[model samples]
Target: MTYTTEIIINKPRKEIIKTFEDSSLFPHWQRGLKRSRVISGKAGEEGSKRRLYINIEGQSIKMTETIIKKNLPEEWHGQYTSKGMKSIQKNYFEALDDHKTKWTSQSEFEFSGFMKLISKLLPDMFKKRSVMVQQDFKTFIEEGKPVKTN
Candidate 1:
């Protein structure tokens, strides 16, 4: 199954792109992400790996993401692996105007067994997750303040 989500940020395309290219700030924009660390090299290089712990309800899941494609200020694609399940995530950015940016994120996963059954009920699980993350980023960029985490 694939999940996609989009948002318009009231910031220049460069600022929005910086949030994605600079992995050091992932925690500030991603609410579900509990922690992340680079494996291969620095933030913006291809083949760089990031292991993220995401909060799923009251529990946490560990997912390792490897960069597959990189086109700065344009596109980024990665593969996420969690519990032996692999998924592809794609992110794109477009300038809506001088100070506006449109961002879209897509993901496709091969789910099975219990997950397949659950996904049927939760139609927009990843979409919601993406939206939540983007909304936080919107706050970070527009307000110069991140969403408070407690």
Candidate 2:
């Protein structure tokens, strides 16, 4: 499955990129994200790997993310792998004006085992989740709202 999601952030591209590059700020916008730790190479750089722990509903999920490309304020790409699914995410950033920035996320997912069935049955779920994450980031950047988790 492949889909694209986008949002316009009410901030300069440079400001948005600065915040986006800071791994420490991820949990504030990324819902259900518990923690992340670098596993190999340099964090955020090409070839770096990080393990992410997240909670969805009541289930704990873990995924490994490897940076594929990092061209800040323009584009970045990453590969994420979990138990039964893998995704390639390409992100593009554009400056719409002096105060507005556009963030576009293109994602392609490959599924195996049960995840394949789930993907077929609910393909829209993935795109919806991606949009929600983008909106969460916009809220965090514009209004200082962090995703609330229990």
Local error of candidate 2 at 86, Å?
0.6
Instruction: List ranges where model 1 is wrong by over 4 Å.
Output: none
TM, every model = 0.88, 0.97
True lDDT of residue 28, candidate 1: 74
Native-referenced Cα lDDT, model 2: 0.93
Best by TM-score: 2
Q: Please provide, for model 1 over 35-75, each residue's C-alpha lDDT reduced to its tens digit, 9 standing for 90 to 100.
A: 78887766657898888898878868899889999996889
lDDT to native, each model: 0.81, 0.93
What is the C-alpha lDDT profile of model 2 across 77-148, one tens digit per residue?
Answer: 999999999999999999999999999999999999999999999888889889999999999999888888
Tell me, by lDDT, which candidate is best: 2
Q: Alpha-carbon error at 122 in model 2, in Å? A: 1.6
Off by over 4 Å in 2: none
